[model samples]
Target: MIPRSISLAIILSILLQCARSSTLDDMTLMLSNMPEDGRLQFPELANKYGYKCDTYNVTTDDRYILTLYNIPGDTRRPVYLQHGFEDSADTFLLRTNTSLVAFLVEHGYDVWLGNMRGNKYSRAHESLLPDDLQFWEFSVHEAGTYDLPAMIDFVLKHTGQKQLQAIGHSEGTTVFFVMGAQRPEYNDKVKLVICLSPVAYLHHSSPPLFPLISLVGGPAASAALSVAAHGDLLKNSSVAVDLIKVACTQKLLSYEVCAEGVFFTAVGRDSEQFEPEFLPIAIGHYPCGSSVKTGAHFLQIAARKKFAQYDYGLAQNKLKYGSLEPPLYDLSKVKMKIALVVGKADTLTAPKDLQLLRKQLPDVVNYHVMDWEKWNHFDMVWGKYMYVFLFNHIHEMLTKYYV
Candidate 1:
């Protein structure tokens, strides 16, 4: 006796209500069961997962104090792992048993994790506090020129190794490439360099936020964010972390929607591979912090579509580099045997940009694209299948190249 349209509408309403109620219940359960240990600092988390972690402070040439984490192994083969943008040494420790650090340690390879300056773990300076504006004046340029060299030297000296194999993910790869191009001497100190989701030529980047900023101009965006955050952006502030936790894990929004909107938009979209349980811990540690200048540099690269030094505008560029524009980092100068692992779905590092990078690098030992179509940018560090898809290849490379 009911009209068909009315009945259909009634059914749809019931289904919608059921879906919302189910989402709320799932969110509640996930929050209650969220692992507290994931929120711990790097060393503590590593220890919780049954791995012995050692912390060392290395001073950069520019006097920035960086924190380095080491997972000791019986062998003299030291492998350095550097994290990506707005991340810390904790990036490698997030996956617990299947983590890259754990895999390397289990294989009897010494692993050292590098935390770049301005991150939560490495914000100390000889004279300036993190609150000081001068302390925030650095970009990836300083990171590559100073942080990488300092950490590399410290690890080599501590292990008494002449050379080490280096693995870098995202911005980590950028810094390594910068070191190789600028301080070519350090290239000899590294036996092999493996780049994961490498980000050097970012003009083809597809991230909406990055490209928007690129359109507005890097300097303007940098200035705006710097002014708003007082030189530090998203550096694991309790307020920001709590808000993110609520947005991503709370019952107000479904976990899938929040994850897709917040994290997946920046990194690639791969819901199946992304561990929902790890979301709380990842939110607590990530967007760990970086200077406005560092972000501006990347935005500049994205806008210009060139792998070059920081752009200080015309006057400053003239004063600094004696030119009206920034100078390009000569990838041809990087003579070390380099291998690249890229995700086909990575939005931040496009295939066209990767081609540009490949065209420039002098010695590319290997170039690999993930077989899985959904493999993404963050998956380099957070993917659940990393051991099966990524680590095995790395192990083979170590066997082939590490001498």
Candidate 2:
């Protein structure tokens, strides 16, 4: 008889609080008991941190179904983060609160992470199967033309925001540059672009075995392998995949395996920056998946030292590009305000290479070099001290622009 309606509201609120608390407890248990080799997908990882994760399936114009993960936030400002070469959305979420996805969401910014074509999450197509060799017939060019635009449009539409902040790591930066140059209109849709460990000019740095491919083997080797394997790269049965799984899973072996397979593949190796506990977690999702053509394209960049279009042979280049030479991307079209998060020890995007790229861009708001001289290419994503050193600068810039 003492205000029945108010009493009902109080009871409902109490039940809701209890439910949230229970969910958090369950999540903590799940994390605490996680197996060494167990890898949680993006949705599960996001929920473990008391945040709601929403997955969006975006169909590119080229027919690939790309997955974008969103951490729902109340803020009107949205940020889209793209992963690097052979990487997936999970790469951005590997370090939990220290990861970019969590950092942005907790700071009142809506966050979205994208998985490019042939990656773990974005492997499906409208009519084609992942096993079909044709599914592996693309490079970053296709990603820039189809995947980025599709993801951007989808995120914008879902969030109902006219413009959003953008962050790209390594190949993410490469693809974004391509989109800005080729699909110039997309430039207007990005508020600020924070480029982490950018990769454009790679003449001085080549991944292991890359020099062999460019010199003696070249496209002939690629063609032979393509014919033999039906275009699938890093196939499940392949020796490379098996070695990666075995070597990287064991604690004792991860140092050599991960350092070589991941760290050395990009740039300098800093044992201090790597966290041994997360090596299995990192390797579980890395080299996510990509076409052999994409691998070949990075080789082309290293060989030519130019951010140019994919090179077909002279005859094919003429037929496809109307010229014997594959044209270099017009960097003049990259009109957005940009920031370069560079490091001193990153061989792939070395200071000289970055200087060449910096000359091409019209408007560079900030060219921030990392405080740690030993900070190398992959450190931006996997460093143990990221939240303390790397993320602080990133957060500062984001805040400056968010206002």
Candidate 3:
């Protein structure tokens, strides 16, 4: 019943998603993968650990394909590891071979690391082409609802487990919180959740970073980016990957990572001024489509006093689906015991945030902290010394939690 042009457009959209991925071969083909010194390069680190990277399609018919890392081991429980923004599963793999994913896998847990949208592994479902400006506008909610839930369901189905253990870092933690708050059903599905640098409060952001974002993130700032975008004056845009190589170092990239990090990283450190440290990005902007329109929904929690989901997005012709505030899932109401890990030096998520989560929970069976003086926002996964600092703590916690 659809017109020929309409049917063709639909088929083309399907084809666009299929073509969007930066396949394994592309990683191998590029000489410019992250520099060996960068902590986020998995192709090199995977080789170091002899671990393999595998790609999976998020949709059955193919709107998105999630790149996941599966290091083989003998664990019965599956730990779903989600990476932070402008990052991918490689963050864990590259930082430590005996890392969380591999550690959980070895200690009787099947470890699966997931890549979210805009990162190297999760570039799909953008309604626009790679060069189109529409591709770059994703916020936290889309990552929580569509990207994360898809990966979790895939892990549950693949592992044949009704419930799985979850671990999230930084924005990774925020997205997970949004997922739990917005989709309370997932709460029942996850056995335990470990939030690293939990960020319900961005007040901890380094001072210099906050003012910069407030400067550009509002409507006036957006208009500037739009006007400049129209003038084709975008910076370092030749290859988004190459831009990654530059931006991560330029300090501007920190703004790209988190809206709040803009303020958080710029203040409060000696050797580290809140500058965007260099790291790898997958390709280009991930088109969040209707997801951006739903921003007012997720912003309510931050606007209100605590963790809550505002609502979900709407489809073109379909009736509205997710609009209610994610049911008030009192952490005190959580049936299974949980563990909370925090980085004391993490300016983004100070001790207070985890304490807030701990205060709300019915059970806080275990608490851990990465108190190293050098640790910062992204260091939990991407720090040069992350393996030295974090691996043992993770080993200790998982052994306690799983056993």
Candidate 4:
């Protein structure tokens, strides 16, 4: 008869093999079923999780077609959530049900997540294909002046709500501030504006990648991206996305390295709270692509330290703004009730920069700093302790101001 110890060892080895095979099979199935365009079908995904999801398309004055994701609730207050740079509605949803959207939906708020032009969901145009150079020529200025207004108009019209809350993250906040200044009338449409990791004065931003971009200079980098993109600055899908989905999710290779790279751009203070498994999924949806001009605009913001229009040469600047230099955004014109939520460890939105912005705004209602010293930029969405530190205050303010 076989030794009992030997028999037990053999059984344990077989069980480990079976478990590994099961994990591999699951990862393979997921890869095959993932969207070809990398657009997360919120409705299908949300329905899988037992929630209702709806979508709408709004055409900007420039004819760029943008998409909006809606998760309806019985509450009367409509809340518009905008994603940051290279991010999508998925950024908020990436944390699963504990995400801000889920929390708001649970608590009875009409949640609408907007995607800017050139993102995965907003790559359509009325007269131009995605490949057209014209489609890739806009900057955040256009997004601020056109996309934000168009989405705002659509949301207010559809819900018949005179005023809704605006919550912006990173570049999301940039657009809101621009719109408020460029089109002051829209100010009345927002009941309150919450700026999360608010980025405007960015001269001091120290994101890991900023140094490389700054060294290249905005114009040179823009030119290089234009050449590489062949006019379609960032496609929704890419080889990198596919590779990560396979490698990290299956844990077949470099999963830890992959996780570190994913968070390197905008890190959280507490690395332990990051969901490694979700890294692959988040990577597939993010870096959704934007105009080369948008990238140049950010580099300009980082170098110049002021919120202004794109920096055309002196001659072009004169033609565009009647001045040799692009005029700074008139923040004093922003009359909305503004609240700034910043992270202590956020290098992307330095506290010093936010302080500068706070002084510029007309009606600054509340300026909140996350309680934790290590709460970095992305932690606002990814932090495990957010329910206690961040979301509670958000809920409180929303309740206090809801009309």
Candidate 5:
């Protein structure tokens, strides 16, 4: 006769195996049934909504080929929209008619969407391929230094305009600050900059997972480095996206559980603003691929609590930055007219950090915090009531400066 404990363990293992099989089956079914619209790229997605979208490839000074998606308008008032970390140009078009891109198009402003290097839309380099380790060895610092200037010059030259308005969300905002500070000459080329959920000094970052991963000598940090050493993380692939959509949207895992684990925990919780129906589409495009180096850079910022260049240890720091510590990006050098936006519930960009940033910035023309209590970081882009809470305010700001 078998012991009760041993028999129970065997039975439990059998049940677990069955559950795993069930989940796999469900995911396969879900992927097979996914709508065709969920697979459309940015250009096709934009065109489907009755917008004439044009694609432009601009090679950065560093030889990184970046893609710019343009929705042409009657006016020469071009507005450049830069996407946040792990996202691509498609981010702006996820909400259809109510999207920020649509809002800009309706207002008759020429819209140019920028895809930072390492993202799926802009992954090519002149000499190195995506598979090469050297090609993925860039952070937001490089994007600001090379990619932004290249794209900005291209946009200005293409539009035959001296200046253009810029809008950046999250890492997008960081790169803009980097460009303005590192390449101060380009500051004159931009008329105004709207920083949404700006991330500069991350001393007070509230995300629970961030601190765990940012710890210098911690296991999480070591694990992150190991993964990053492999090359690109979460590179956009339809199969991978479909699997995520199934896990997040289908009954394999409840949407609330997925959102809480993935979105809410990382940023902030705002259930009312999050639309369940958009989950599949959102999953398909987002986490659009980035180098582990870029993520490591941000993690260093969170860990060190300073907006400084990537730390390459003592010997390497001396060789690269010419100091024991990475030098801070000079905020005072960012002399362009700027507007700052924040969310009350955003954990990633805490209010305290923004307060410090405001003091550092030389000229902040406007500063506005979302009135809604539950407004979080992703809400700036994915919220259902974004038009009411964010877009109108953005429109007003553009009109104030440009119109």
Candidate 6:
């Protein structure tokens, strides 16, 4: 219900720059320049449906911002939604009148959605430059440490409530556990946590991508990306992937394989159906690119089957890459009433991966390795039927667990 005309001129102006020779940094700038009206979708969605939304900076470091959609009803209880990787509050706020978000809005429970750093909406790092991967040093760490806490505190302060219900999907669940484990008091702040497709203690295979990152990626490959120096390489990489996906999709439409490669296998989704929900009109504002040095850090977990720190290119990988270890988090301490929704057919983070997480976390309330039949990593968010089948259980689970 947000007015579409708010500062379209400004958005178009930036879109012009982003479209021409775009880089990671350029994409980062685009979010900051978003029209106030455009940024108010969450709140406006709430308002149009008789709810209110407000977005503000909540990070101690000035980089974390939380967007809250408030709907006041009989229940004083609140629900907070944490988006998955490479997504924003839009994950919960897209053009839909169904799903738990709208339902929660009509029910009068204040529902707030969060955007972690590196993704759009919460990229304001005071000391970090979007042009450099160094600016995104925290990775998922910031999501747990900075973003979650800020969101909780903001919700409590505004709603005048002592506790709230929490829900996370994919990396959203990863961060919930990360935050709860590191800050146990936060466990007290949430009445319950509904985790969708939680991942842990498992090695997933992303077809061609698995080998691609393992053999060609790592710190050294990240260094190679540094030369391109597109701070917004995530967006560019997304573009590259989209371009390739288009070719594959067209071929699929024609009932054939054109080149026969493994690119789609590693990407976590079938190329033919990767059309994201509510594709960002600006596309350039999408900002999840990181150097292989940064990616090299994840290789440790891919190999070790646990969430470990990023390797700082120590003596182990000294020849091709530098030594560095990204921080790690423990997943066991999370006691939230979590729910996991995983696609049966996902290769990126297989359904078995979600099973591993369920085994590790004793407090899980609901667990589903979806019989999606054809679902994959990206299906949980972008699949055309997600709002139909995926979130059907969400309303019942959330209403039952909280308030």
Tens digits of per-residue lDDT for model 3, 1-403: 2333443354344335434754646434432443453533455566666655554667512254556666644436778787664456765654344455555644666777777655555555525443454554455766776677888888888877788777887667777666665566777777777766665554334444344445443333434544454312222222433333333233333234332222234322313422233333322221111222223322344334445433332231123334333444345445455666766556656566567777776666778776676566665654556556776776665666763
Give the lowest summed-lDDT range of ten residues in model 4: 1-10
> TM-score order of candidates, best first?
5, 1, 2, 4, 6, 3
The lDDT of each candidate is 0.82, 0.76, 0.53, 0.75, 0.82, 0.57
Query: Candidate 6 overall Cα lDDT vs. reference?
Result: 0.57
Question: What tens-digit string does per-residue lDDT give for candidate 4 at 1-403?
Answer: 2333443354354345444664656545746633332335556567666678888999999898999988888537889999888777777776557778878888888999999988878999999987777788888898999999999999888888888997888899999999998988999998898888987887677756466556634545656666676655555575433444444444433334444443543454356555554555565676677777787788787776668888876777898889988889899999999889998878778878888999999998999998788878877776666667888888887887788
What shift in Å separates residue 134 of candidate 5 from its native position after superposition? Answer: 0.6
Could you tell me the lDDT of residue 141 within candidate 5?
96
Candidate 6 or 2, higher TM-score: 2
Which should have the higher TM-score, number 3 or number 5?
5
**What does candidate 5's lDDT look like per residue over 1-403, in tens digits?**
2333443354354345444665666656655544455678999998899999999999988799999989999548999999999998888888899999999999999999999998889989889998887788888899999999999999999999999998999999999899999999999998899999999877877756454544642324533573556658678763454445555545433345556555776798887877666766677677778987787788778787788888777776888888988899999999988999999999999999999999998989999999999999999888888999999999888888883
**Residue-wise lDDT of candidate 2 within 1-403, one digit each (tens)?**
2133343344344345444554545433423423443366778877886779888899998899999988878548888899988788887778888887777777888888899898778889999997787888888899988999999999889888888888899999998889989999999888888999988777666465465547523445555555566656664334455345444555444455456544655577666876566666776667667777777777777776678888776787899999987899899999977899998887778788888889999878889998887888888888877887788788787777773
Where is the poorest 10-residue window by lDDT in model 5?
Answer: 1-10
Clashing pairs in 5: none
Worst 10-residue stretch by lDDT in candidate 1?
A: 1-10
Top of the candidates by TM-score: 5
Whole-structure CA lDDT of model 3: 0.53
Return whichever of 4 and 6 wins on lDDT.
4
Estimated TM-score for each candidate: 0.89, 0.86, 0.66, 0.86, 0.90, 0.71
lDDT minimum window of 10 residues, candidate 6? 251-260
TM-score result, candidate 4: 0.86
**TM-score of model number 3:** 0.66
How many clashes show up per model?
0, 0, 16, 0, 0, 22
For 1-403, candidate 6 gives per-residue lDDT tens digits of 1122323333344345446756767444434433333344455555665545556666644464444444454337778888765566665644446545665666666677776665545545666666665665554555676678887888888778888887787668767877887787888788888766565433765644465556534545555554454434354246553332222223122112221132134334444344422233212222233333334434546665667544534554453234345444566677667777777667667656666777877587777666557666655655556656676677777778865
